[model samples]
Every structure is written in structure tokens, then in C-alpha cells.
Target: MTDQKKAKKKALKDSQLIVRIAGSERDRFVSLCDTLDTSAAREIRRFIRGFLKEHDDQLDGQ
Candidate 1:
């Protein structure tokens, strides 16, 4: 494909992070997980997406 397509592919692959939350935090995470009805990975991804949408520009200048 094109350079832009290749960049997009790389970006998608690079856009994931692995996190370890403590047990107390995990209890909260699992509560949100159940509310979202998704695996922990997905719930975290959804939260990050919404967070970034709301604060990306503000965050970038920090």
C-alpha cells in the first residue's frame, strides 16, 4: 500500500499499552468492566478513547 497506509498500520499496532493495576484498583476496574460488559483490555481502551477525545488538546500542551 501507500506510505500513509503503512503509517496508519504502524500507528494502530503501536497504540496499545500493557498495564498492571493493583488489587484495590482492580476491584474498581472490574466494576467498570462489568458495567461495560467487556474484558479489562477493552474497558481500558474505551476509557482512554473517551478521555483523549475530551482532553487531548489540553493534554498536549502540558
Candidate 2:
């Protein structure tokens, strides 16, 4: 397999996550994301990946 194909497979988003936040906060966040030409889901995924990288050691037990 080529490197590009391997990367495509690795990048698959095959999961669901549910989060609850105050309705007003969620509305504002979504509006900001739209203004930045991105979706809330995309930002959340980026945040999750960054957070995981930052605290990976703390998650080793899980």
C-alpha cells in the first residue's frame, strides 16, 4: 500500500462522541466555528487529539 492510502485509512473518523454543554455556550461556540469556516465537530476533534497528546502519560492506565 502507498503512504497516501495508509494515511487515508488512518484518518477515518469511525466513532461517535456525545457531549453536553450549556445551550447558550454551545450556540456561541458553533457560531464562532462557523465564522472561522469550521465545524464544531472538527474543532472538538482537534482539541481531543491535542489534549490526548499533551496528557498521554496520564492515560496510560486506561
Candidate 3:
């Protein structure tokens, strides 16, 4: 496979996260994500990546 294809395969989402939140909050978040033309999972993944990048230095010290 090509390098780009290999990277794309490596980035596949093969796992899941189950978060339990209030129904109302979940509805609102999904609605906002729809209005923004994005997905809840996409936004959550972005947040997770940014959070890890922000805290990576702190983690390396431990």
C-alpha cells in the first residue's frame, strides 16, 4: 500500500467510547453539532487530541 493509504488505515477508528450524560445535554450537544455541520464524535475526537497535545509535556515528566 502507499504511504497515504497506510496512514489512513492506521487512523481508522476501530474502538468506541461510551459516555453517559444527561439526556437533555446530549440532545443539545447533538443539535449544536448538527447546526455546525459536524459530528459529535468528530468534535470529541478533536477535543481529545488537543487535550493530549496540551498535557503531553506534563505526562512526560511522570
Candidate 4:
């Protein structure tokens, strides 16, 4: 890959989001993800990308 591509990929992976939720809810989510053979982070990222695509037009005026 080119340097620019590598940099972009690195930038995409560099950020962290910290969310505070009920401990029980978090445990349940983690268990479900484990059963599904995926990590919680992957599911959260998928949800975030889908959400952005769905609502991207709302940002046109902002």
C-alpha cells in the first residue's frame, strides 16, 4: 500500500470511544458477541458506520 493509504488506515484505527453503560448490560453484550464469534468493538464499529450512512444527509446544512 502507498504511504497515504497507510496513514489513512492508521488514522481510522487510532481513535477511541469510551462509553459508560450499566455493568450488567455490558456483560450481556460481551457474552452475546462471544457467542457470535465477534468482538464487541467490531459490532459497535459496524453500528456506527451504518448509523452515519443512514443519517449523513442530516449534516448537509450544518
Q: Rate the local accuracy (lDDT) of all candidates.
A: 0.82, 0.94, 0.93, 0.98
Q: How far in Å is the alpha carbon of 17 misplaced in model 1?
A: 2.6
> In model 1, what is the error at residue 46, expressed in angstroms?
0.6
Q: Which digits, one per residue and each the tens of the lDDT, describe model 1 over residues 1-62?
A: 99999999788767657677798999987888789778877766778889999988998878
Candidate 4: worst-modelled 10 consecutive residues by lDDT = 8-17
Best by lDDT: 4
- Collision pairs in model 2: none
Q: List the residue pairs that clash in candidate 4.
A: none
Supply candidate 1's per-residue lDDT for 50: 99
TM-score of each candidate?
0.48, 0.74, 0.77, 0.81
lDDT of 3 by residue, 3-61 (tens): 99988878887678999999999999999999999999999999999999999998997
Model 4 ranges off by over 4 Å: 1-8
Count of residue pairs whose backbone atoms collide, per candidate: 0, 0, 0, 0
Which numbered prediction scores highest in TM-score against the true structure? 4
After superposing candidate 1, which stretches have Cα over 4 Å from the reference? 1-11, 31-36, 59-62
Model 3: pairs clashing at backbone N, Cα or C within 3 Å: none
Q: Which residue runs does candidate 2 get wrong by more than 4 Å?
A: 1-11
Q: Which has the higher TM-score value, candidate number 2 or candidate number 4?
A: 4
